[model samples]
Target chain A: MPIIINLDVMMAKRKMSLNELSEKVGITLSNLSILKTGKAKAIRFSTLESICEVLDCQPGDLLEFHNKE
Target chain B: MKTQTILNIMFFLAWFVFIALLIKAGTILTTFSISWFNDMAAEKMYFDLDLSMYKSYSPIHYSLIVINKVILITAQAYVALLMTELLKGFNLKNPFNHLTVRLMEKICFSILVIWVMSIIHNAHLKALEKSVGLSAEYLDGSYLLWSALVYVLAQVFKRGVEIQTENQYTI
Candidate 1:
């Protein structure tokens, strides 16, 4: 998909470990890992909201779109 | 008993019965007994469809009968096996997996094979009617419709598996 998850980059910039983000976002580590690894098909608005609130970042920082060749 | 156990027993019994019939067919081909068919016809059961119409039987005619019976029994066995596989899938934690969809596809393929075999058998019966005065006319349409329905069901199951994967991956 053109839409890519950049969750790992945001987490790195914020110096947030996966376990810490999972605890703060109230989601399982596996689910958070799925998103961070760009394996997630979609992000729920509530989950995105929780992640943004925890990391203090915009949705754009966690998601990116690059045109596929 | 749970439904899965019941289904398992039923499928096992069905396979056993079909295998028995296959053995009986083999014996019939080897013995070539008219009285066996006559006894079945006398019972007026499923075998009485067009048995009365055959006044005499040649070796070739008996061979045709044997072949047609084998085809029908093979189709039934195929269906029974597919049903067992489907029941096994239903017994799983995730019944709507890719393997389930593949089993459904195999079912559809088996139905199609049965339909084609039925058509060929019907044509052979017509030929026998012209050559040997055997008045059997078996033209079943349900198998074609059934195959189409199963094909659609396989597609639905395929979509279900895809959605399940998407759901798992969604965060």
Candidate 2:
């Protein structure tokens, strides 16, 4: 859970809606929603690559780590 | 296709066993009640398992044995019914799910209950054998092991469900 998906931020910066990003990345809207909401257990490398290509960003731009008590 | 056919056959067999066990329990219980009015009814009970001699020796033990047998048969019948439900929901595509897991647990628990009841019934018979002229021949020691195996399988199936869910959610 510490590794967070900042998919919404990347999508916003790229002026891309969730639906647009999902279409460009060839992923389902529900799956994109899951990633955006940080509910997915894992993101495949191919899927990440697709998302990064669509959003014009690196994996680091869509992911973050934080230590919390 | 072969697996589906086999599962269907097993499902039918489970229903058969369930009905058979229910009829057996019903017949024994009816005979038990009738014996109070017609003592000879106990002499020609279902399964040809005459209890007249045991009744002559001790009516309490006779009733106890009959009741125990009826309960054991009924519980086993319940397990069969649970098995039918389990097989009914058998999804070869998504075999590991919540319903199957719960039904498998129920089957295991019911079998365990039957096993414990059989143990007690056999011990009771053993204690009364010297006077009754009948040794305990009904104790199937395999029920305990079978129940344990089912319980383990249920747990494994539970793990399978977890892993499958995780996989499904791993988009």
Candidate 3:
């Protein structure tokens, strides 16, 4: 439950908006929003790779884990 | 509209017609058997009408008639639900083709069973010295079959969503 989605951080670091990332990745805005807002129960490795490739960031930069106490 | 969308629309229209028919049938049956409708007693009530006394006369019964109407109404609801889901295929992002196919097969089988059971019930009533009013055997069978089919389809749909998620990962 504590799986961290660092999408917002990555977008800000890259000086990119959600619309720009969606357009560049060829994915719908709704899906990218789901990823960014951490509403997605799971994320696909392929999608993560695409995001990393587009943003020029490592996977660790886009995801993290937090202990649920 | 696509072929499936057109079919879905037709099915929805037919569902509406069936619902109207159900209401009409209930009203007609009640009008003709007013005494039966007014009686709240659980005991079987029989009336002897002399509409055609020249020919032999028998008492009009109410208990079985009311039961039949109730069953028919329930059957109509089941059919409406089935049609609604079929129509939903047009709007669903990833319709579960396999589940829909299986549901279609079940519906066909259920209809066949209903038809056969109704014929037998009608024949049985005719042999028992009573005019066959509508019987709910067919409707009851159809409702049960469709309810089961819907339950199974829901499970299949859940699995399909999971599969879609997995495919996204592999891509």
Candidate 4:
């Protein structure tokens, strides 16, 4: 719950839509949506690598840890 | 030979056992009900155990013995029904889920209750043995071990559900 997904921010910086990134990364729209909405529990390294390569962003840019308390 | 075929076979088998248990429970119930009005009805078939001696001993004890058998058999039948339900909702692709885990827990608790009830049934019969010339043969106490095994499996299934959920969320 403390982890935040910055997928949307990176996608916006890259000026890419969810469908475009999904097609490029070979991931499904629903999965990308989960990552975009921060609903994903964990991302596989292979998937993260694909997303990074597609969006031209580091994994750190897509994920962040924020303390709630 | 496929897993789905095996599961389908098990599902049908569970239903078969459930119906068989239901019929047995119903027969014993009918026998007990009839015995209430007619003493001769006590000497009947399908009870697995001949408990008619208690009928001459006392009406209350007779009723207790027959009723206990009914409850235990019905409970066993209920477990079979749950097993059928569990297999009914099971999906091979998504075997780990909340519903499956919940059903496993329910089965575990039901078996535990049966085990506890069996122990009590045996103890009560043991106390009455000398007075009624009861046989040493009693309900098997192995259900305790069975319930324990089911409880452990349910815990493992709960963990499987968590892992599957995490895997589904993984992108």
Candidate 5:
């Protein structure tokens, strides 16, 4: 629950809309929404690779850990 | 709206329609029986009763009636359960693979049960000097066969999910 998907922040930094990212990454807009909303339980490496390649970022830039306390 | 929520709404609507149809059928059957019974009673009063034919046909008629009701209720319950599982996806982890497998298992079990019940039902109808429509017989077999196919597909999906999860560990 403490894991964070920083897709929204990365998209903002890259000046990209969700539709643009979805088209670039070859993932559906709905799936990207799931990742952006932190609703996905897990992400495939292939999907991560696509996102990283398209956004010019490392996987670490898209994922983060936070302590509940 | 989420797919699950939409499915839940649709399921509830389907139940409402099923209940209405049941009530309508019950009313029609009751009226028919009452009229037929009165006519039979009048004939019995006026003449010496030869009750053998009536006694034989009555049980068969009753059995057919019972079978029809069972089939309707069983099918409705199956659809309702399937829709509920579909609707739960929005909140589930690994919704597509996880929920689909669960749904497929339920569907398989339901189809098997329905198929057996339907065979008994068709037999009852035949006993009553009635024939089931070709479509009805086809539906009975198709539902079960399709369920089996889906169950196999769900296993493949489950394996894919497991492989994906394992590969994540190596990375």
Candidate 6:
């Protein structure tokens, strides 16, 4: 849980909606929402690659690390 | 035949047998039957509980016999019903769900109850040897190990359900 997903920020910077990103990344809206909400247990390299390509951003730009304390 | 069909057939048969046993236990059928100590084998291999001793039909004696049969039959019926539920899990889309795991644990618990009842019934028979004129000599407690195995299997199923949930949530 310390690894937070900042997919919403990247999507906003790219000026793309969840539906648009999902359509371009070839993933379902629900799955994209899961990634955006930090509910996904894991992200496949292929899926990450597709999302990065669609959003024009690196994996690090979409993910962040934080300490609970 | 499909596995679900087979399981359903088995469940119905078990339920039917349980109902038959229940009827038999609820009635006075055993009182009139001739129970003998042996089948007249050369070595006198077996003994049966003779209920014909109460020719006058003492209410207390008749009730005792009925209660004993009812207890044993009820335990058997409960075990059969548990097995039916266990079989039902296999027909589900996801057999390793929480409900299935709970059902498996209930089956293990029911088997333990049957095992404990058998031991208690044996003990009662031993205690009543002087009055009843018959007793069971040996106690076959093999089901305890089986119950332990079933309990372990239920735990494994619980773990499986956890893994399945995690996999589903992994997206």
Error of 4 at A48 (Å): 2.6
Question: For model 6, how does the per-residue alpha-carbon lDDT over B1-171 read when each residue is reduced to its tens digit?
Answer: 487788789888877877876665544333333222222221221125344433223435534544555676676777777676667556456778877788778878877886887677566556656676643344466878988999999999999998887776664
TM-score of chain B of each: 0.73, 0.94, 0.46, 0.93, 0.55, 0.68
Distance from true location, Cα of B155 in model 5, Å: 2.1
lDDT of 5 by residue, B57-85 (tens): 46455435444644655565655557555
DockQ of each: 0.81, 0.84, 0.12, 0.91, 0.05, 0.53
> How close is every model to the real structure, measured as TM-score?
0.81, 0.95, 0.51, 0.91, 0.44, 0.74
Quality of candidate 1 docking, DockQ: 0.81
Residue B166's lDDT within candidate 6 is 75
Docking class of 3: incorrect
Model 1, span B108-155: residue lDDT tens: 998898888888888888888889776675767589999999999999
How well is each residue in B37-90 modelled by candidate 3, as lDDT tens digits? 443322222232222211113233333434444454445555555565566653
lDDT of 4: 0.86
Q: 2 or 4: which has the higher DockQ?
A: 4
TM-score of 1: 0.81
Model 3: how far residue A38 lies from native, Å? 1.3
Model 4 spans with C-alpha error above 4 angstroms = B45-48
lDDT of 6 by residue, A3-66 (tens): 9989989988989999988889898998888888888888888988998898888989988899
Ranking of models by lDDT: 2, 4, 1, 6, 5, 3
Question: How well is each residue in A1-69 modelled by candidate 4, as lDDT tens digits?
Answer: 999989888988999998898899998999889888888998899999998899888889988999998
Candidate 1, CAPRI quality class derived from DockQ: high
Fraction of the native A-B contacts that model 3 recovers: 0.10
